[model samples]
Target: MIFTIAHKEFRSLFSAPSTWLILGVLQFIFAWFFLARLDAYLQVQTQLAMVANAPGATVSVVAPLFGTLALVMMMLIPLFTMRLLAEERRNQTLALLLAAPISSGQIVLGKFLSMVIFNICIIACSTIMLSILGLGTRLDFGLLLTNALGLLLLTACYTVLGLYLSALTKQPIVAAMSAIALSFGMWLIDVGSSDSGSAMRALSPSAHAQSLNSGFIFSTDLLFFALFIGAFLFLTIRRVNNNRLYA
Candidate 1:
């Protein structure tokens, strides 16, 4: 049942021109960034090649590229999230969904997972670009995998937050803006600490991701991500239930 709703939402996203426009812009940003990073990386590689001791691809250059991607995903998700619930409410389709045999949790999960899967596809596409990073360099596969997991965990948190915000508002624009603001606020909170404020970063999903970025995948880090994703999923379900009550 949830899968059905996810399929519908995923298909609907392609039907919307604005979604395609945003996606095109995302592609441009990624391409531009990848080229720039690779240019600098190739230069650094040449310089390091002069020395016998330097590794082919330094973590310094590679980690920042993935880090940049993590931040970009943080910004891009709200664009997809806005229409999830807001469009349904605006078109008066939500009532139909609510009236269906499906639980509010199912509706919420379906929409949320659809966006999550869509995002996964977007990130999956980047593997080709990241593979380019590995072609001539001795990149650590395990480190890359760890970073990918970190990004996935972070995306889960952002998607649920956006889905919940979309469910709260009837206006799609308002939902998009609110979700972006909220996600950006969380990100800025981490930025303000500059990796020095463990208290602040520890609680922030962005911070947990930075931990994985450093290749230290602690049990606490895994627990934090699991809790983060679960907490937002629970909140979104609760929010959807509240909407049903208010209706």
Candidate 2:
């Protein structure tokens, strides 16, 4: 049943013209950044050869691209999630969903799963551009894999928060704005923290995402993401379930 809902939601995304427009803009932005980074790396190749143990293509180009994608995804996810529940409620379709045989948890999970799979496709496309570098020079497969994993986790984290916010209101634009405000506020915590182990840094998903982007995966970072996603999903389920009382 969850898979059925996910499939329907995935198809619905593509049925909207805005989804294609956003994807096209995303591709253009990512391409511009990738080319700029590659050119910069090329310009410094001569100087880098003179310095022993200098950073290579993987360090200069690929990792930063992942980091850039992380930032871009942070900004884009709210738009995707804003309509998940808010639009349903606004259009008066949520009541039908709420009264269905399926549980609230399944509906939430299915929607989340659709978003995750859509995001993975976007991430995979960005990764292909990075992979082109491998044709001419040796690339760090392990590092790329780790960064990809990190992005997936980061996307999941963002989606869950956006989902929770979407559940709070019937106005999709308001939900999008609030989600972006909250996500950006948390990101600011990372930027403001001077100490690596500060409480503010620890609480920010952006901080842990940077750690994973460095290709060094710690148990602590994994734990943070796990707890973050679990907490939000739990909250979303509870929020949706509450609708039953008034339905």
Candidate 3:
């Protein structure tokens, strides 16, 4: 049943023209940035060869692309997630799900899974540009793997938060705006940090994601995203369960 709902949700996303448009535009931007970074790397190759243990194309071009995609995901995830529950509620469809035999957890998990799957596709598309560097240079597969992992974890965080915010209101645009505002706020916390242990920085997903982006994986960073995603999903379940209770 959970798989059924998740599959339905995934297909429903593609049913909209905007989903295709977003993916197309995102890939185009990623390619443009990639070519620019590659061109810059080429221009500096001679200078870098004279330096000791200079960074490679993987570091100079590929890694930064993933980092850029992280910021893009921050802005775009809410648009995909805004309609998850908010649209259902707005269209008077949430009531059917609430009254069904399925638990709120199943419903929430299903929706979250669908969003994760969709975003994984987005990450994969962005990573394709990174993979192209292997044709001309020795790519750092380990670094690429870590960067992809970091983006996936960050996407999970954004999806959970967006889903929770989507549950709070029936207005999809309101949910999108609120989610974007909150995400951008946390991103600011990461940007303003001077200390690694600062409270605000610790709460920012981007702070942890940066470590993985640099190919350094810390257990604490992994735990932070796990707890962050779990807490939000739990809260979403509670919110939807309350709606079921009232119904």
Tens-digit lDDT string for candidate 2 (177-240): 9989988889889888889889878999989988778889999999999999999999998999
Q: Rate the local accuracy (lDDT) of all candidates.
A: 0.80, 0.92, 0.93
> Tens-digit lDDT track for model 1 on 157-181?
8888888888788998898899889
Worst 10 residues of 2 by lDDT: 238-247
RMSD of each candidate relative to the true structure? 2.0, 0.9, 0.9
What's the ranking of the predictions by lDDT, best on top?
3, 2, 1
Cα TM-score per model: 0.91, 0.98, 0.98
Roughly what TM-score does model 2 have, to 2 decimal places? 0.98
Which of candidates 1 and 3 is the stronger one according to lDDT? Answer: 3
TM-score of 3: 0.98
Q: Candidate 3 on 1-247: residue-level lDDT in tens?
A: 7898899999999999999998999999989989998999999999999999999988888889898999999999999999999999899998788878999999999999999999899988778768988998889999998999999999899999999999999999999999999999999999988887899899999999999999999999999999999999999999988886764
Q: Model 2, 183: alpha-carbon shift in Å?
A: 0.9
